[model samples]
Target: MAITTDKMEGTVKKELHVFYVLDTSGSMSGAPIGALNDAMRSTVEELRKKDGEKADLRIAVLEYNSANRWVTQGNNGVENLQDFFWTDLQATGLTYLGGALKELNTSLSRNEKMKAETGNKVPVVIFMSDGYPNDDWQEGLQVLAENKWYRAAIKIAFALGDQADTEVLAKVVGVTKQGQIVPNYEAVIKTNDLQAFSNMIQVVSVSASLAASSSQMLGTEVGAETIVREAAGEGANTDENGVVIVDATSAGGDIYASDATADDLDGFDVI
Candidate 1:
């Protein structure tokens, strides 16, 4: 087997604030939800490998159908998942992408304000979905895009299965250095199998890492035995609610691209 390794000659601390704006509509009932749950659980397991101590890692989950529910945090509050058992989500409602996005925008603003007031590091945001938005996400998207560096953070969009709209996701991902040259550069899992979601998470985490790290675009390759590193993006990234980080030395280190951003602020410095 070939090996992928980056000299750990230097160290980088990234703190992440990941908010899963997922679609828990009735459509996601059967395999999709099962798969999504598995994917999320496996992701946390991998995250646990990174760092599981105190508020050292914060996780936020946003479940949206015709509406949105901030699982970890309040309706607009950003709470740390370090306190709750994050495995209690039900499926019921319509698919209101716009409402979800609007609420999400509010939550982030709240998260940032709280962090600033308490002298905490800024966070990264990730959006995952399997369907298109029923609402006008454009305004929310614009709001997210022009929120200034301090708040407008690195964002990655993953559209799963055929239900997800690639064109829309593409627009949301925006134009990145790596993405511009070769669009769809980030990991996109369009599989029907749920177990594959774990693999998707592995790839996503890598992309998040690339976003948090140096502005080299994603260079990590995805493969079996992908190892999620702890404290990968400590200050600017989190293991619980953090940016995805994959090392070239690990299995799935090559999936991330440079188009992704860690956050709106100049949080983490690349080696």
Candidate 2:
């Protein structure tokens, strides 16, 4: 639950940061918020699963609804999150996506230079919504694209239902990759299923934690493990036991790292 030791010293530590930007507008009142909550709770459960060492992760969230009331708006809103565990947020106000994003950009860009020399990587952003911008969001998106803050972090956008602007979501995805600015983004269009959306974010969070850990082992200064819970699943962690050897795989022409080299995930089907 805390940063114990420095895996790498005197280097720029790469870190994985994710921001769950939820739209609490009018439409997301019933099923949407409910599903979001369940999925979020499950995500926390899964990510806490141990794989040898706890995967370091720093997560924050922004809940924007009712042009007047922003249900959530903290890059690291876990303090509030711990007190509440549901995602079915109410939809009340006009979506101030631009204002919300500007808040996020400012939060990420605050100590930009400190990360460069210290190896702090940029945080990833997951923009989830069911409709187009009700406010001036173009500028906020533009700042994200043009500003060179934590470019190493990823920025993803998901449209919960059919109401999202496909073009915009795709464009933002590519623009947010670290080092290499990814101008092409791939967003999931099935917003009706908040369970699946939450699932994807869960995988992303854990994977990013692994990537961040790898970067730290290589010696960089990303975040110093704000909080890392032990394995939270029922079955003991097979990955962390060391009995399950993690070796690089080279099947066909594809190559995978030792830690996540899965030729096939036994139980689930990849969609």
Candidate 3:
């Protein structure tokens, strides 16, 4: 008698999509926007070369000023987000974050960029702003919170200057509602310094892209919690001064840790 055992086949490579929601309002002009351009250019180059080894990486960018526009195009209102390329952005107009959020929700489906059956990793969304919304952003946020993909995506935000509303940014990046916490991965970085601003742009973009690739290689899904851990290692969780960045927490409360004690809590015992 002869017996044969079946051999498992290799998994098909899945798509990893990264969406960038950028505020190109007039306030972002001068050094802030300049740094953003440079950092984004570097990020594009880094991801192009680094992520191809493990996964098929794709990117889509939505910029909002007085209105929102897609920097990259797709066919028939659907973006075929594979082998992504980046286009440098300029700053102008008002912060219409709501419009951008609405567009993001529309684009994240099987009819658009997502393929739920393919084992595609959850998408990552990075939002950056230097001011508050000039439109009905709350409505948009409400709609976005209901989107399955938006809920699952790795969300991060940067409050680039002091004028940037940490409260609003907090709500957008890490929380779905006033008191609810985002599922796993969400972070908000705040800094008024341009150098630190640019550094974080590079750090977060590259780290997120690499995490997507690593997950593909390991045959594991990219976990938002995991992204947070890896990003901390790459110094994305702090300012140039080494202060750990504070993210939004449970809506209406302290925007940051009450004291520096939490910063030193790593060495303390909790039992």
Candidate of highest lDDT: 3
List per-prediction Cα lDDT, in the order shown: 0.52, 0.49, 0.67
Order of quality (lDDT): 3, 1, 2
lDDT of 1 by residue, 1-271 (tens): 6655763433433345556678888877877787777777766555545442212345677888887877765323554444445575667677777677666666555454235333333454556677878788777666555444313344555556667765565455453323331223232333343554446565565445334333432654332111223212222212232223232222233323232455523445643
Writing each residue's lDDT as its tens digit, candidate 3 over 239-261 gives: 45323353332111222223336
* TM-score of every candidate relative to the true structure: 0.62, 0.60, 0.71
lDDT of 2: 0.49
Query: On a 0 to 100 scale, what is the lDDT of residue 170 in model 3?
Result: 65
Ten residues in sequence with the least summed lDDT for candidate 1: 230-239
RMSD of each: 14.2, 11.9, 9.2
